[model samples]
Target: MPYLLTGAQGQAGRRLLSYVVSLPLPNTDAQLLAAVLAIRAARGGVGNVTGTDLSTLRLEDARAAAAALRGLGWQIDGVLFDGDPTAAVAVTIPDLARETGHPLPVGEKLRSRVSGWVARTLTAKPVKKLPPAARLAGLFLAAHGTCDSAGQIPADLPEACRAALPDLLAKGFLAELSQDRYRLDEAVRHLSGVRPPTGGQATRPGAVPSSWPQFNADAWARWKSEATPALRRHVEAVEHCALCALPVDRVAQAFMVAPRPMVIAKATMGAYGKWKGLHPDRGSLAAEFTVAFRAEHGHGPSYYQLTSGLGWGLDRSLGAYVVTRLVKNEWLVTTGAVPWTLRPGPAAQAQGIALPKARTEAPGDVPAAV
Candidate 1:
């Protein structure tokens, strides 16, 4: 299967195209070519995407940039990020042998924190039906597309729209890929329900009430009351590794281990190619962590995420983050319910196993937007 790329007209898009073009295609390996195919496939996934307003970006300028890349043998496969599948978990690289194919290259916008409260809020049942934005904050850390770099969202929204998911979902503005997902669908912006926020409305941590933030200031105070005043709550926020600064060696391992089971995915610089999810115990994560430690300049350490970070749309706040352990065995990443893969054949998952698929949708169905 060819690589599928999505969001061809956003910040990462043009830059990615430019970078790929700069590379000498012929000398590239088969695996490299497969990665390109995966990117192309992502482009094909797009449908009724709400084109970013790009207030100052002239259409002609974009065309010129696109044309220049076209001259460089850059071929986009399909549309991706249909709505807001900010929850995608890995860099869909196919584990292809000489005979098999590879998966798409879906880079995640990594987040540093691991806690269980958030996952229950978004992925748990009885509440899985909650609106998409409830789980939106961390979308960027999960599966950011080209649009993420530009920070370009729909314009023409009211001044009060602190968060306007409803409006965007209405007029078929952005295709509703799934419950915890979204795709840009600007054609029906006017009909969208995402509205502006009103007076005194807080978008801060614990705003959702149903998820992790439920234990806001007062609750948080209660939980850590017994601990040292200074360390009342030190739910590891972020970390940096100095080893990454050195030239990387191929001897690398990835994993997920800790309080809970999570998909440990990180994009290391000069490390093992792209991102890899390592499971603890099941895998050699401790040593991997050591390597990660040695691979950095102790600055901008790779994001070692542990928590699943699912919940009501937002992934902001120190509490929302959870540290997790790497999986010790071979693992696969999924979206909603499917094992994200690069196999070109059928998407029909295993028989006894059923997963949620992105259903085509309209925006008005989204809560908060109205």
Candidate 2:
């Protein structure tokens, strides 16, 4: 069973599979690869795939899969089977590249996220050794299933996948399988595509209470009304982010409360010393990721989000130390301990990498970008 993902974690996977199933491709190994490749190319229409990626799929006919994609006007530079295993081959999809009518109109983060989901789902424990059709079927079932209820199989599910249902049931991927309906096993429920019900007791266990005594809505409104235009825009961006959908009290409380001084443990500093040596380019990479993240999300990434999205694999304490070091070195900046205010600092700007507002504002007014 794959580790459980949050509602936000599964969203991009659901959208990616939904888009691929809507296309004209048949249910075969080729279509399975297309789902992976298409999401990778969603942002810019060109994705890189190595021969190792092709071999890992255990496709019955790698050449046939590549040929089928070529038939759809996709460009595969060279034969996938003959290429050097480690070399990345650029695959271009015309439809995804277009400015208008892009089949998958997603941001850079979402494209990376969905692509990762597809890879992980395909190689999940229950289905990794199964045939390509069975693996693909598992993806459909997992994406459509809900944590609390059974789901009807999507109408767009491939005919090949339908035949592979028994394999999934036998492998413990499905807890229930009736005609036209199925439910994911408890272990794999985290991969469910459906958003859980909201607006009652919060769906997430141990969620912050929806109502915070410290938060006064009227006071918040008054504060915003009196704020400068730039500050107001920044506040509203965090408060009403479509992707975050944070509770009003949560948003208000973050802004109202003063941030406590950070206390770095000696162990965390030790870890950072070792980690930094292994990642000399961490500063530049972190800066670049923030620029792309801010363009997609109206605000900057949170500490946990920044590390995880970049695949830095840092624990909480170590991550804090690394970010602190980056700030001290002027590679990243934050707005007076405000959450999600991280952006490029002087070091990044000197290297010609900066946020839009950073480029436009005077040096002293850089904080206004938040």
Candidate 3:
């Protein structure tokens, strides 16, 4: 029977290959090999099969590879092997394709964000003023009063995450769980609380996270320290700008998913986001826009991002403030910068400014006003 093995490393896997190659008589353990290999695949990614251990994988594209393997008659095993104290290899199997084949498979390794919305809201809905992340952050300020939890989110995150907890709770953006874990609610997504970044931040734990890089401890910590409170202020401090009916400018800014905002460029174009200019009434008319479609439509729409276009160098007028909607609830793309440092209120105020007005859908499309 086939028996799968996994986690056996470089030299060790080669050694095992040698042993199996030299075995004069065939000893079948295909069942065992297949089970172990299957488990390893489920937990990890696609891997290279060599002797009795699995090594190097690209799990991102698993389905196609699985089909390939099934055609080869390999089942999986649920066992593991250790080459030594700090090293080891993994394995999988079904049965030998050939009773007598020379050598074994070698190893091959490989590896391998948001939006604009509003205006064409589809529905001629009445727009209401709302505070964005700034207000959310401000509420945090009111409760905490100061940036006490600087330097990092407490090592005991359950306790420290609380520092920014109140703001989320108040906004109804986050839900507290009976299991003691916290989760962002649908409302929490695209919240002004999240800050899109442009990379260059520390990439380690305890260092500031970069908007562009994947989320890490250091970046997350920096946000927990620097921006949590300010973000609160940014969100809460809003009043009016008829042109941009949202309560605050903070609400006007849509985050450009930080992790990888560029992918949407080729994927989604011609998507209109918010528009605006300096207006009377409020010093700056900034409003938030929504870009939503029925998820029931089968394949959901991808949010086109427009954040990086707004920075210092790449600050093409169209690129900067012109962002698209991101609906998938990507945390790193949205909030990578928020935990680190909030751009002071005055500064943030000037940032996400835009025009705001009710969407003009067809007459019949109008919903009964409350």
TM-score of each: 0.22, 0.56, 0.17
2 versus 3: better TM-score goes to: 2
User: How far out, in Å, is residue 60 in model 3?
Assistant: 13
Q: Which stretches of candidate 3 lie over 4 Å from their true place?
A: 1-313, 318-370
lDDT by residue (1-370, candidate 2, tens digit) is: 4335443445446556666777666556887888878977876689999989988888888777777888889998775668688988888999888643344545465467567667777887788899989988888887667777888897778888898998898998888898899998886776665544456333532235666677787999998788666667778897776445567777777777786677898888888889889776667767766776576557887676566555566887788778888989998998876678888889978877788754354454425667
Winner on lDDT between 1 and 3 is 3
lDDT minimum window of 10 residues, candidate 3: 110-119
Q: For model 1, how does the per-residue alpha-carbon lDDT over 221-313 read when each residue is reduced to its tens digit?
A: 344454333222111111111111111111011111112334333422212222222221212222222222221222111222211111112
CA lDDT of every candidate: 0.24, 0.73, 0.24
Error of 2 at 275 (Å): 29
Candidate 1's C-alpha runs over 4 A off are 1-40, 43-58, 61-63, 71-73, 76-219, 225-326, 330-370
Among these predictions, the greatest TM-score belongs to: 2
Candidate 1: residue 333 lDDT (0-100): 19
Residue 338 lDDT in candidate 3? 27
Considering TM-score, which of the candidate structures 1 and 2 is the better prediction for this target? 2
lDDT of 3: 0.24
| Ranking of predictions according to lDDT | 2, 3, 1
